[model samples]
Target: MLDSIKEVLITQEALQERVAELGKQISADYKGEEVVLVCVLKGAVMFFADLARSIEGDVTLDFISCSSYGNSTQSSGVVRIMKDLDKPVEGKHVIVVEDIVDTGNTLHYLLENLKSRNAKSVRLVALLNKPDRRTVEVHVDYQGFVVPDYFVVGYGLDYAEQYRNLPYIGILKEEVYQSK
Candidate 1:
């Protein structure tokens, strides 16, 4: 699988260090509140697990799978809830954990949906952010890194459902996408 990768974008050690720092900040900010982490699934599998462990206080965990990409690199500009949250978010200090923030459509849709559900407070915590590609205004409270626009894979991110198992984050070669 490594053969497919052209170069590593973010090393595993670098990601871990950043995650630890984010955990510290979150743990400090949410010192005396009921923290509930809603992890966006598939892509957030690795990020959610790592962030949850790094947090010092008690935090409730939940999962939701939403998608705007359908077998392509570009989003369809429409977000769909593939799997809704298992529990209601009313009166909870909800934090939406995401693997990457790209077009911002999914996060915007999610925030609106959560607000409609009457969550006490809602904020975003994304491990990676692609600022150049944002098509909509979205708020990201806790961000690990702001990256340039690139087709990145690994650390739960994927290309055609492959490369999620990679320990580090890497940018796919142009040929990989062009050939597809």
Candidate 2:
């Protein structure tokens, strides 16, 4: 599948380093407090696993999967909750962990949903952010990389559910998705 990639945007080493750094910062910010990491599933799983190991203090992980895209390169602007968190986040310092924030629709919907649950606080931590595609204003408290408007895959990001197994993040060639 490397043949489908036009360029490598972030290497595996870089991604690991950044994630570790983010973990350190988050550990400092929430020191001595109970943290519930609500991981946005499927895509963010890889980052979530590594980050959880790096964190200090009391940390718990929950997963919620919301989808805005199917097999397309762009979001549909519609957010659907495929799976919800098993545990309630009420009265806890909750962090929404996402693989990428593109168009901001899904994340905004998720944040509002989580807030309505009576969580003491909610913040965002995204591995990648695409500001150019944002349709709504969303605050990302912590971020790994601000990527340009390119179709990226690998390291938990995917194209039609493929390329996610790749270790590094790379820009997918337009022709691959265009042919669909």
Query: Cα lDDT of model 2 overall?
Result: 0.94
Tens-place lDDT per residue, model 1, 111-157, is 99998998999999999999999999898999998888989999999
Candidate 2 lDDT, 1-180, residue by residue in tens: 889999999999999999999999999999999999999989999989988999999999999999989888878989999999999999999999899998999999999999999999999999999999999889999999999999999999999999988889999999999999
lDDT accuracy of residue 85 in candidate 1: 89
Angstrom error of the Cα, residue 152, model 1: value is: 0.1
